[model samples]
Target: MKLNVYADKMSQPSRAVVFFCKVNGIDYEEIKVHIPKGQHLTPEFEGILFFFLFDEAINLMQKLPAIADGRFKLFESHAILIYLACAFPGVADHWYPADVFKRSKIHSVLDWHHSNLRRGAAPYVFNTTIAPILGRPLNPQAAAEAEIILSSSLSKLESFWLKGNGRFLLGGNQPSIADLSLVCELMQLEVLDEKDRTRLLGPHKKVQQWIENTRNATNPHFDEVHRVIMLAKERQQHQRLKAAKNEGGSNMKKPLVSRM
Candidate 1:
């Protein structure tokens, strides 16, 4: 039986899953779930939708980017990556090496990511970009706090994880599941204005290089999966320009105040 994958490319974890499948030649059917449209909440999607955890909130049923292979079912991006790497005999070893110590380091990076890198990056992007798109008020204070955390996370990622001459995390020459996971999370910032995105990521040159390396390594697949985000960014730019034009026209229409 073929592997069935339900996901939305716009989602970080979902993109990670898609990249893994594409890079590894894993044959799977892609099922797109439009989360923003409330499609995931529908009864038909209850079991296949992936839900992101916010604060203390958790929904046990939401599972997106999920896989169903014959009788087996799996959720969680890290687990799915590891499972694909291990389950397929022809997959490259570097993805999740058989060497115990190297594998342990990869695992460590994955675990630390949830609480540190992802914690900082995901919230920062969503709060600043997604919330506003959904008609929610922007929270400057919260976004600022998340930015500080994200900056610290990037620093650690550069100094500690991608230290020395390594192109990927944990000093690995090849990209690992950890690299894909964190990179996708950071990719969420593409929705921001170019200046803001550059300002947030510019200080960390290593991170930037790593992103390029990962993209090069993954090639067309990575770019293909990220097309959704690129489209969204373009739409955002169009909206901003239209809004500014409307405001300018309104201002011109207002009569000037004459001095008495």
Candidate 2:
């Protein structure tokens, strides 16, 4: 039976799952769930067991990047990646190595990512880019705190994880699922203004190189999965420019009206 994946490419986990499927040649049907439109809230989605929902109001226990094969279902991107690696024949070992120690190291990075890198990175991007676009209240204090945490997380990512003389995370020459997961999380920052994105990522040369390396390793599949995000970022930039131009025009007209 073919696998069914319900995902939105705008989401990091969803992109990761899509990338994995494409790179590994896994046969799956892509079901696009438009989160902004509230499609996931409908009865059709709710009927599915283990549906990967991505609402902030939902409990944290709910999983995302979910998959289904027949009646069986699974969620949690990390678990799903490992499952794919293990279940599918001909999957490369570097993804989820059979060696107990190597596998444990990969597990360690994945576990650490949630609370550290993901916590800092995802919130920062949401606060800076998505919140403003959605007309949600922007919390400067929260964004500031998230940036500090994100900076520290990047430091650790550089000084510890990628410190060894290896191209990828955990000192592996090839990219692993952990690399994909974390890279996708960091990629969220791309939606920010170019200045902010550059400031946040500039100091971390190694991290930047690792991201490039991972993309190269995954090849056309990585870029293909990321097309949605790339388009979104472009649209965001256009919107910002338009808004600024309107603001400037309004400011200029206000003086003329006041003088009259």
Candidate 3:
């Protein structure tokens, strides 16, 4: 069977997976999972995981961005990426290179990304931007706290990882999987109002440049994959505008009833 990549583009990791697959000319079919419709939890997803015997950590979660290669099933974007890097022929060496120490270093950055950058960015973006679009109240307090963590994470990446000579992470001229994953994660911030987004990212100038560098390196594929995110941002902006207009209309005073 051909490789099957199950993904929802709205998901950061999912976008990373799809981007990698597309950019590398890997032959795979992308099965779209409409996450907002709760399709990820459907019986169809569970049906494919009949052989769910991978380690507990990688056990199929019936989540977006999983892959099925023959009888083998895998979840977790990082695991899938590593698997793809090794399993497929014609993948570029720079992505998950043959050099063991470099591969380990990339893994180190990915590990930190899950716990730090993703942790902070996901909830922070949700609270400040996505929550309201989903009909949940935006939580300013949570966003504020999340910003502190995200800012710290940015500082760490800028200071520790990207502080050296490379245009990409870990001093590499070409991007690695870590670079793609982290940049995709940061794409969620595009949903924020310009002022808010700029304020948050403003301090980390190097990180900003790194992002552009990654985008440029990936070129057409990167922008094409991220069109989903850009569309999402547009939809959210429209929703906000409509909501504001409706609120204003409701606030306008009606003519008084004289007989009351």
lDDT of candidate 1 vs native? 0.83
Candidate 2 local lDDT, 32-66, one digit each (tens): 77666555666555644334443222212444577
lDDT of 3 by residue, 66-112 (tens): 88787677788998899998998799999999998999999999999
Model 1 vs. true fold: TM: 0.89
Write the number of the candidate with greater TM-score, choosing between 1 and 3.
1
Pairs that clash in candidate 2: none
Model 2 local distance difference test score: 0.83
Give the CA lDDT, 0 to 100, for residue 163 in model 2. Answer: 88
The residue-level lDDT of candidate 2 at 77 comes to 86
TM-score of model 3 (CA atoms)? 0.88
> lDDT per prediction?
0.83, 0.83, 0.87
Task: Count backbone clashes in candidate 2.
Answer: 0
Reference-based lDDT, residue 44, model 1: 48
